[model samples]
Each structure stands twice: as C-alpha cells, then as structure tokens.
Target chain A: MKEIMAIVRMKKTGATKKALVATGVAGFTAVKVIGRGKLVTDTDELEKCREKLLALGLDEVSDAGDTETLVTSFLDGSRFFPRRLFTILAHDEDVPRIIEAITTANRTDYGIGDGTIFVLPVADAVRVRTGEAGEAAIW
Target chain B: MLLIRAIVRPEKKDEVLAGLSEAGFNAATMVDVVGRGKQKGIKIGGMVYDEIPKILILVVIPDGEKEKVVKVILSTARSRNEGAFGDGKIFVSPVEEAYTISKNALGL
Candidate 1:
C-alpha cells in the first residue's frame, strides 16, 4: 500500500474531490492547512505600494531605508495562503490514475500555488472495527 | 528519506514541535484529526465518545535523523511521567522523493 498526499488550493478542493471519486477512490482524508512555496512576495500588492510611493515624490523608493521596511511588511502578510490537504491510500497500480485526476482538476492559469502531491510507503494498515490487517484492511 | 507520522494528543502538539525544532528538525506538517486506538475510545456516563481529537504531525527527515527525531516526539508527546493509553502512535515510512512545487525542483 501507499499513502498519496496532495496539497491543493482551497478553491479547487471541490473539483478535486469529484475527480478523485470518478477515479474510483473509495475513501480519503482532507484537512485545512496554510502553507507557502519558494516565491514569497505578492507582486500585485508590491506594484500598488510602489505606485503610492512614486505618487508621493519618492522615485528612489527602492533605495529609501523606510520604504524597504514598508515593502517587507506588505510582503509578510501574504507569505502563507490557505490550502487543503488530501490523504489517500491506494494499491500500487492505482497511483498513476489518481495523480492524473488530481492534477487535471487543480491546474490553473496562475501556476505557482497550484499545490503538490507526494507518495509514501505504507508498511501496514488495520481496520479497527473488524480487526482486519494489511491490504485486506485497506480494500 | 523517511516520513514520521505521529498522532499525538492535541495538548502535546506544541511541545512536540518545540522539541523537534530545538533538536534542529524544524519543518513539520500538522493536521487536526479524530481517531480511536486499541482502548476503543472512552465512555462518560450515557455517552460513548468514539472520535477523540488528535494532532497528526508529519516530519520528513534524512535517514540518519530518524532516531533523534523519534526520541524528541516520544519524550514530549507523552501525557504524564510514566505515560498512559491514548498518548498516541507514531509510524515511520519510506519516502521516494520530495519536490518544491514553486521551483519545480526534483528534491527537497
């Protein structure tokens, strides 16, 4: 067995769920999370801030000591964005289909925060009510 | 690399994270979950509360850091001096690879 984890944008969760179900995933776990990737700045906000500084007659805002602090503060608030994380357990052969379903559902024009998927090995599984173990428990 | 999934008491989540951070294993992902262990949940008066709240902390570390990381979680996630039932469980699993979504890099 393998555990497939996908971190996706909050808005795309509903579509992702439908796609996974269509691919024959019986069960999965999802939770709300806040995370970020390598890119930290919010360029749109930075542009607005820059325009404001320029209107105030500070053309050299990039070299201004205080404006540097202003830019950093504006970027800090956007460092982490809301996301949804889904965890699914599946047979080895089913991994590819599941990944394809998720990716197709989540891909958007704005690429950076689309999300990520990871697969990890699962040594064992157990069903509490039936006391069943291994693959039997998962299926 | 190996990923350690530790399902611990909600109250002990912070302590565990702190312990790991102090030990230099700083990055971890946490989720709020509800589960029941071998004790089969708890009963209070007329109610049988089967879904107990838990915090699942996931940390991916190099193969060599497994012992140290697990040790930190064990000590800090324990409820009392001697430990007790429902202290939670930890599972370690192999990780094939890691990637940075923004950079599209191959590995962490």
Candidate 2:
C-alpha cells in the first residue's frame, strides 16, 4: 500500500476534495497545520531580498527613494497561510491518479507555495474487527 | 523506531489504550476517522452505509518490540470471534527520524 499526503492551501481544499472523490479515492484524513518557507516579511529578510534582486542587475534601484516601496511590494505576499494536510492510504496503483487529481485541483498561476505531495510505502495492514490482514484489510 | 498506525472501531479506543499502557507502550496519538473496508460498508435493512466512523491510533515504538505491540492492539481492538467486517486496520512503516519538539531531542 501507498500513503499519499497532499499539503494544500485552505482555499483550494474543497475543490481538491471534490477531485479526489471524483477519482474514487476511498478516504482521507485532513489536519490543519502551519508551515514556513521561502516567503518572508521581516525587515532584514526583505533587505536581503532587495540585495539579491539588485545583484541580478535590475539597475532601477539606484534611487534610495524607490527602494523602500519596492521592498514592501516585493515582500507583500503572505508570510504564513493556513494549510490542510490530506493523508490517503490507497492501493499502490492509485498513487499517481490521486496525486494528479490533487495537483490539478490546487494548481495556481503563482508558482511558489502551491503545496506538495508525498508518497510512502506501508508495510502491512490488518483489519481490527475481522482479523483480515494485508490487502484484504483496506478498501 | 517504527511507526504503527492502527485504525480500529471507535468503541475499542479505551481497550486499545489500556492494552498499550499495560504493555508499557503508552505514547500514541488518536484521531476520529471515517472509512470503508473491503465490504464497502454495510447495508442495514434498506439503508446503505458508505462511510463508517473509526479511530486512528498512531504510535512510534522501538523496532524490536514491533510484534509485541501489534499483538496488544490486535487482541484489544478485534471486534468479534473470527472477525467481522469494518474491524479497522493497522499499518506498519519505518520512521526515518523522530524529534521531541520542546527539548530538541532526537529519536525516542
């Protein structure tokens, strides 16, 4: 079995769920979590971003007056956004389809922070009630 | 340490907990979950139930004690003799790393 985890934006969760269900992925668990990544809003980090941008030879930041506004606008994106982690345990063959559905539902024009998907192997599964083990335990 | 994920009948949570604690395997996380087993849910009279409530218990324990831990859960969580549908499932997997957040300690 394969455990598929999709970390996605809160706004896209509904659509993603619909897509997964449509693809016949039987069940999933969603947990709310906070994550930090490349996006930054702190002053020092903003300054560093400006330095990197300048080093790229943008040349437009020669005037001190324009740099402040430029920096603010550059870092105006979200610092931290609520994310939902969707975990699904499925048959190995279904992993690719499930990942595709999540990506298609959550895709956005802005490339960064769209979210991520991970697939891991499950050694075995046993049904608690019937004592069924292995493939028979999961639906 | 290996990660053990057990999905069991919600009503069996207490027994499972008791078993784990008695066996000196107390660290676990529990969550309410809904799923359908190989039976694809049950049809009671005229009603067709698609999703059933289950409890998911996650525990990370030392590798050597895997069989013992599994036995504790299996005995405590099983629903009936010879087993019945919707009993839930237990999944075993390896853990690459584990950390204690407050102390910044690694492993168990």
Candidate 3:
C-alpha cells in the first residue's frame, strides 16, 4: 500500500476532490494546514522593490542600515499561507493515477503553487468494523 | 527518513507535542480524526459511541531518531502512570524522499 499526500492551494481543493472522486478514490482525509515554502525571498519581487527605492531617491538600500527595512517592507508579514492537505491511501497500482488526477486538477497558469505530491510506504491497513486487514481492508 | 504517525487521545495532544518539541523534534503535522482501535469503541450509559475523536500527529525525521521520538511520545501520551486502553497507538513507516515546495529542493 501507498500513502499519497498532496499539499495543494486552498482554492484548488474543490477541483482536486472532484478529480479524485472521478478517479474512483473511495475516501480521503483533508486537513486545513498553514504552511510556507522554503523560499523566503522572491528575487523578482526584491528587484521590483529595489527599483522602487531608487525611484524614491533612496539609493542606500544596499547599505546595512536600510537592508532590514527594505526586506521587511517587501514581506507581507504572514509567512505562512493557507493550504489544504489531502491524504489518500491506495494500492500500488493506483498511485500513478491518483497523482495524475491531483496534478491535473491543481495545476495553474503560473505553475509554481500547484502543490506537491508525496508517496510514502504504508505497511498495513485495517478495517475496524470487520477486522479486515491489509489489501482486504483497503478495498 | 521515517514517518512516525501516532494516533493519540485528543486531550493528550498538547502533552505529546510538548514532549516532542522539548526533545528537539518540533516539526510535525497534526490532524483531527475519528476511529476505533482494538477495544473497538466505548460504551456509555445506554449508547455505543463507536467513533472516538483522536489527534493524529505526524512527524518525519531521520531514521536513527525513531527510537528517541517514539520514546518521547510514549512517555507523554500515556493516560496514566500505568497506562491504559485508548492511550493511543504508533506506526512508523519509511519515507523515500521529501521536498520543500518553495525551494523545489529534494529531501527535507
């Protein structure tokens, strides 16, 4: 068994769910998560701010005194963004299909925040109701 | 790396998290879930509450740190000194790889 986890944009959740259901996924767990990517600085945005500072006659942005201020102003304050985390368990054969469905649904024109898919190994699964185990329980 | 998933009593969530943090394993994901264990559910005065609320805590760490992490959870998540049913259960699985979404770098 495989545990397929996808961290996607909050707005794309509906589309992702529909796509999963369409692919015949029996069930999945969705959690509201606040997370941020590792990129703390966006070079393009920084460059834009640099230009704005130069326009304002503040050429000391490169100096240590104003560096902190410049960086702080560029930051929106909240480092973490809201996201939806979907955890899906499936047979090995279904892993590829599920991943494809999620990607197709969450992909956007910008292509950066579509989200990430992680495949992990699941040693076993059990159905509490019937005491079923392994593949029997998953189906 | 390994992913340690512990389905613990909702009330004990804070203790477990604190234990982990103090032990230097601060990164974890928590999800509220409902399920039953070996004892099944609980029986009340006249009704059977099969679905019990639980907090599933997920922590990914280096494989060598599994023992330390699990020990922390076990000590803190117990209901009582002697421990009892419904305290919770833990599952450790292998994580092939991890990626940081923003950095687009491999391995966490």
Q: Point to the candidate with the largest TM-score.
A: 1
Predicted complex 2: CAPRI docking category? incorrect
C-alpha lDDT (0 to 100) for residue B90 of candidate 2: 90
Q: What is the CA-based DockQ of model 1?
A: 0.23
lDDT of 1 by residue, B1-108 (tens): 888999999999879877887787655666788999998899889888889999887777878988999899999999888999999999998887554444444454
For residues B41-99, write the lDDT of model 2, one tens digit per residue. 89999998988998877677777999999999999898886777777889988754343
| Candidate 3 lDDT by residue in tens digits, A1-139 | 9898888889998999999999999899998875433232566855665565456645454776676576555343223456799989899999878877787787765444456667798888999999999988877
lDDT of 2 at B30: 59
Error at B68, model 2, angstroms:
0.4
* Collision count of model 3: 0
Is candidate 1 or 3 superior in DockQ?
1
Better of 1 and 3 by lDDT: 1
Which stretches in model 2 have alpha-carbon errors above 4 Å? A1-139
Q: Each candidate's TM vs. the true structure? A: 0.61, 0.47, 0.59
TM-score of candidate 2 against the unseen true structure = 0.47
Kept native contacts, as fractions per model, are 0.28, 0.00, 0.19
